[model samples]
Target: MTIKDTAEEWEVRATETPFKGNKTSVRTDDVVMPGGSVARRDYQVHPGSVAVLALDDEDRVVVIRQYRHPVRHKLWEIPAGLLDIPGENPLHAAQRELYEEAHVKAEDWRVLTDVFTTPGGCDEAVRIFLARNLSEAEGQRFEVEDEEADMELARVSVDELVRGALAGDLHNNCLVVGVLSLVAARHGDGLDALRPAEAPWPARPFEV
Candidate 1:
């Protein structure tokens, strides 16, 4: 369908500054639906984000463990973050986050997939990247105030990563999807053979 025919037209009806100080902007709108029905909705359009599934020479994938306050738990995840400034593309953001969060830099980069984290409620989208040719670097650069990310970089077998996803051990959906897409793109039907048997994720935190 064409954009003009399928797109929903929206007009802002009113706005209210519910809170200030944080970098959040809440917007309320009233729109006329395609069937000539009127409806009101609220939206929070955040800046887009990027994530990386970095691989090393030994065929090990980089994974990180960090405390997530929202979930009130520490979880293993691929390196990722939101774009703080406007006009930053996913590749550049991915490269920056690799160094900022994991203290590593990649010499080569490839786009794995683009995902909408929650299209129904938010405008947040994340670009997943495959990073390789890694080298050690310095410390992380966190953006949020009172933010403390004690990151542990681990090298996990791709097979174990997939298995973790299947067993519901890995909680991040984007990370699972990104790694699987990269595996499929590289090995076609042979991806299953690249997985290590009885692989386990790193339980300790380490720098690059």
Candidate 2:
């Protein structure tokens, strides 16, 4: 049997939206179980997201520190943002995020990995990209507000970030996943063997 995620939706007897937010909403579904029993599952419905792991010639990763109210901590993370529009091209979104968050642009791009953040609680799929050949973006930096207003930026080596992640110091989902995936790719067949940046993402389909 192939060890890959397959899409197969269980029978939904009923579904409802109890709460609706600006970008996401709470969804409750009465699903049929294996024993012919019905169960209610509530989860957040998100529009999906894209993240960029910008690697410089020095082998450092661009990172940002920002406040997350829900977690009540200033977590260090890579550049990431929501898809904004349904079926929006993830590569474009990732590039925009890298520029806006880190004022960086990349010449080489590849699909690092894709993941489901908090699958049990939210349907938020994130497509992480490996962005290399980095250079500062041209033009004024994007203005940030709220938690982002106090954001901090840094570039740390891949090894240090991996250390922090394993030491239980770094907790950002994107950063952890991105860095680890980067390490894995380097150790595996190699970065060149990784999927193309525009590779198909069944989790969040987008136009070329």
TM-score of each candidate? 0.75, 0.98
RMSD of model 1 against the true structure: 9.4
What digit string (tens of lDDT, one per residue) describes model 2 on residues 22-132?
A: 999999999999999999999999999999999999999999999999989999999999999889999999999999999999999999999999999999999999999
Which candidate gets the maximum TM-score versus the true structure? 2
Clashing pairs in 1: none
Q: Candidates' lDDT values, in order?
A: 0.70, 0.95
User: Candidate 2 regions off by >4 Å?
Assistant: none
Against the true structure, what is every candidate's RMSD?
A: 9.4, 0.8
Give candidate 1 regions above 4 Å deviation.
1-21, 138-147, 187-208
Model 1: lDDT equals 0.70
